[model samples]
Target: MPVDLVPTPGAGPRVTFTGLGGAELIIGLTGQSRQMSRWALGFILIAAAGTALARRGCGSKVIFIVVVLTVASLLALWLPATTDVANGAFMAGAALVPLYILIALVQRLWNSLFVRNM
Candidate 1:
């Protein structure tokens, strides 16, 4: 069957050209979403970090969470942006989950290495 071979445009803000194949070429991206999700995810990240930091006498877990979340939000901001509000926001938000888990691992390692009582 013939693949849906769409004309891939040159590099720009919108979709990027991947490559040509035997029959059809695939476009890496299609659009850009500069608004909408940006503010939403930004606010959520701020609130989450604020809340994590606000807790009094934060333990190692809290410190780890705050640092991890903040880093995740930062990385999310760096994620490749798509053409749709949903896509950009989704990619940004999705990028944070694994970051949080990594934070947990780092905290555990720190605890074992430094804080023996923890």
Candidate 2:
């Protein structure tokens, strides 16, 4: 490699660091590696499971809704970081998982509260 091609300490071109979601020291690029947050992983798993469950007996509309929401949430949480772009709005996707969970809880509560009386 040419001497000029070497990345100097603190004098190299600006490099955007993106989170690798648990991958560390990949291909000699330490800057790209990041520890995956447990919260993020949990949310991903929940969304995946929810999607799977939604497909079993739910209508097409319901399945579509679930898939879209889950995809959008994942994209929002990960796309910006993957692309090396700084967009705070993308982080909002992290909330969607909990939001969906909350919605389910509310629905269950409603059903339990009223359906049992019938």
Candidate 3:
């Protein structure tokens, strides 16, 4: 790491600080799915259990459920949308770059949450 590699305050390269949904970037990470399958099953189990619990009474576990569902969705949307064969408007690829980043963040968060498995 060299000082020259760093940019000055105002001279820094511009970055669009998208809020949560800012840039939608999707990344397909391989090899972890097999390891995480149990967690995935656990999530499904939780979903089914949570639905039953919700019928009984809403609970804090909903947050965890929502987060899990969100990860599953973004992961599903990420890889195919960003693939080279993905067809869309001319800017699809350019726009997908940010979308892909959002996916990466979700993946990172998921990985961190399961650090032992990760």
Highest lDDT: give the candidate number: 1
Question: Mind giving the per-residue lDDT tens digits that candidate 2 earns over 1-118?
Answer: 2224467688957776678575344233324333234335544654565555542443543554456456656665676343222121223334444655666788889898888763
Candidate 3 lDDT, 14-114, residue by residue in tens: 76575866565545554656535544554445445544443332234445445545554554478553322222221232333354456557878987887
The better candidate by TM-score, 1 or 3, is 1
Can you write out model 1's per-residue Cα lDDT over 59-82, one digit (the tens) per residue? 644554556555655565675442
Q: Is candidate 1 or candidate 3 better by lDDT?
A: 1
Top candidate, metric TM-score: 1
| Deviating ranges (above 4 Å) for candidate 1 | 1-83
lDDT of 3 at 63: 52
Runs in model 3 with CA error above 4 Å? 1-88
Q: State the lDDT at 113 in candidate 1.
A: 89
TM-score between model 3 and native: 0.24
* TM per prediction: 0.33, 0.29, 0.24
- lDDT for each candidate structure: 0.51, 0.49, 0.46
Sliding window of 10 residues with minimal summed lDDT for model 2? 83-92
